[model samples]
Target chain A: MSPSPPQLSPKELSAYFAFTEVSSLLRHSVEKQLKDAGQLSYVQFQLLARLGDAPGGSQRMTDLADGVVYSRSGLTYQVQLLEQRGLVTRAPSPEDERSTIATITDDGRGVLATVFPGHIATVKDLLFDSLTADDIEGLERVLTQVSAHLRANPPRSAGSRKKS
Target chain B: MSPSPPQLSPKELSAYFAFTEVSSLLRHSVEKQLKDAGQLSYVQFQLLARLGDAPGGSQRMTDLADGVVYSRSGLTYQVQLLEQRGLVTRAPSPEDERSTIATITDDGRGVLATVFPGHIATVKDLLFDSLTADDIEGLERVLTQVSAHLRANPPRSAGSRKKS
Candidate 1:
């Protein structure tokens, strides 16, 4: 405030903001595209789409939460919303009823099938469009490192609960 | 809502979901860390931090909006909130009264100083902890391309109303 604080070196700040903007735009674009397939947020779409492919077409809710970026309760709420929409079914696991199992419904797969082309196109246009076949190779390489770093440290404990 | 349907190959889904999860988690980690820096959403922190070194300690609201990932209205709203907190001030430029120039205040710098160390530490922990210097360079490389792509195709129409 006084002498005017120095800016983050352009190099540091650029990477910081790059992750933010790229992800936000990607999320917005993907969500918009998914809506045309069904009234699904990206989270909802990911959840159903994941369950749609499990060996038995089902997974524990905890497994589902761990499988993606959403938290347990947040995912449960979305799964409830999806259940209401008839895209997925949630029922207690027979072996361990404390946790529910989520299964994708035929309707969910139908919607996913309906939306797949647009979803792929949107992802390609917004993300892959800007990358080369080599850039994709580079992205995959760096993303693996990043994904491992994040998984190893896992931020839910240390991250924001801003509304509070 | 009948039976299970055939699905995309697991390898394909793995690559697809990996990209989404890693990107979202990294951004969330960075933003969450900023909360401790005094309610700075990652975007807000980036805006204020960037403006700290803007030429003449001021920048056009539209330029500021483009500098960060936020929508023009989103930028305006957050700048107003920061102003209310006595962190920044806006002056209508004589050159373009339609565009306001925002300057950081001493009080704002104090807040940033207090918060930045921990934020950087978190970035290091969540992002760079496991990586070699080379990995960092690779991430920088890939993200630069992604950033360039996003900036080239910003979502809004150029002739849209000024957010401020």
Candidate 2:
């Protein structure tokens, strides 16, 4: 194999390492809070929270999968788990007979209602508590730019999904 | 419930969402690169890279787990996989008979050498490409603070592991 290319600058390396460690730790903290509050995983809470925020408390499965950055098969499995627990329901879409739609149930909303406070608190403690208002604005601007670029040029693995 | 504890301010909410999306996308991008370049998962790459970076090219298992934000059992599994591939070896620590030390083999460094360029490129493309130097500084500062806090008060699930 060809020799490794030039190394990243110290600044770049430091920034990337810190960004990664923070992300992992934050996810761990949030996952624990969700589990303790409602026995929910992070992605499960994301799906429920997204549906709770939707226009009709529901979204097409494909849409939910894309919004949450999950594989369609993975989303289907989580939805099935939620459905079994009575927190969500899946049905044939009215607009497209071949498509399935996922809707949050009253139980789902109730779970969100129960878990959200702890979620918010966990986020604040692990993330926002250390950041100043200016830091928040700066992070928002930087991450928003990066996120749009990533969404436009998604990884090949995620590009096969039907776009919503 | 306490009415969802009032919504986060738009600025805070936007920042948090952007942060979450950016973190997820970056991981996906990096995972794809590692898989293609070295047939490595992100966590496996992390362990290898960490071992390569450590002084004397070795570290205790518990220290590795804590540094990587992984569960002790999970780290044991990954270390075993690497050992099976002859990339890393685990031996009784001379300093502490009860502890096992993981050391990178020459083959492990070879794999990291092969994949580091692609890893750096992927990180730059998905993250640093859009970020200004000022953004890098801000991110490093904010994330370092957050990581330090989270490491100090790690999630309950991960707290059971012996700290190194």
Candidate 3:
């Protein structure tokens, strides 16, 4: 016999529903903004944003996948697309030939600068506008705790992928 | 010159990052579980779940799209796939011949029964485990507020789509 489904309290169920609903709505709004403002997908925006924020404006492809919680092959495809668009370039890492590093180009930074205003506005209008300061604080605290727990057993982390 | 980007305070920035990261991670985990346990995509599972929850195990195709925050074309394709799987049936509504109504089949309910244990457990492990009761309360409150605001100007609501 199959295991019994776990019971969730009414409050827990409503919370989960609300959380997923808001995430879906907010993501949709931001994705539309990114597409309109810079013709970038959310994943592409995340890739460029992460690389742009890196200390040297670059990161290993594997690290990029881990940071964005994306699959390696999928990340490679996105990087290739970015490269074709002249927004980023990839090269073998000097310290480790097996690893590749991706660097955001000047064009990539330009795209970020282009889309950021609309992106920020969409986020602010859809999410932050409804939140009070206390709500924001609580959101940060709860999500940070949840993030740490999820990262501890990350599905796409280099260590996790090593086994597969 | 392009308008300057909206300024997000440091705390607000961190809160947004934490929210997106946790949602991504949680979604990834649940998607993996749904695939492993039932050969269902997250969207398919959502469709079935929504149908199951609706009165009489049915809903209008347009309403399904709006409720799921999915595009009309995309939702139609998913419904087709589910129909092919014998999990749902699409029929022209008697009251409105132009509109299609989707009804979940017994097989769809069976699939839900099969996959829900793992889905609930995944949600609990990846999300609820990280939260205190107070955190859950705060999460629900803040997210419910955000959802109401976003829904007010929803991008894919029937009224919005008519304009497009």
Order of all candidates by DockQ, from best down to worst? 3, 2, 1
Of all native A–B interface contacts, model 2 reproduces a fraction of 0.62
What tens digits encode model 3's per-residue C-alpha lDDT throughout B34-76?
A: 9978889999999999999999999999999889877799999
Q: Give each prediction's DockQ, rounded to 2 decimals.
A: 0.28, 0.62, 0.64
Cα shift from native, residue B124, model 2 (Å): 0.3
* lDDT tens readout by residue for model 2, A76-146: 99999999999999999988999998999999999998999888877877787777888888877888888
Q: Model 1: per-residue lDDT, tens digit, A7-83?
A: 44445556656766677777777777678557778888788778888987899998998887666779878989988
Give the whole-model CA lDDT for all candidates, comma-separated: 0.73, 0.86, 0.86
Model 2 pairs in collision: none
Who is ahead in TM-score, 1 or 3?
3
Better of 1 and 2 by lDDT: 2
Interface C-alpha RMSD, model 2? 1.9
Question: Which residue pairs come into collision in candidate 1?
Answer: A1-B105, A1-B106, A1-B109
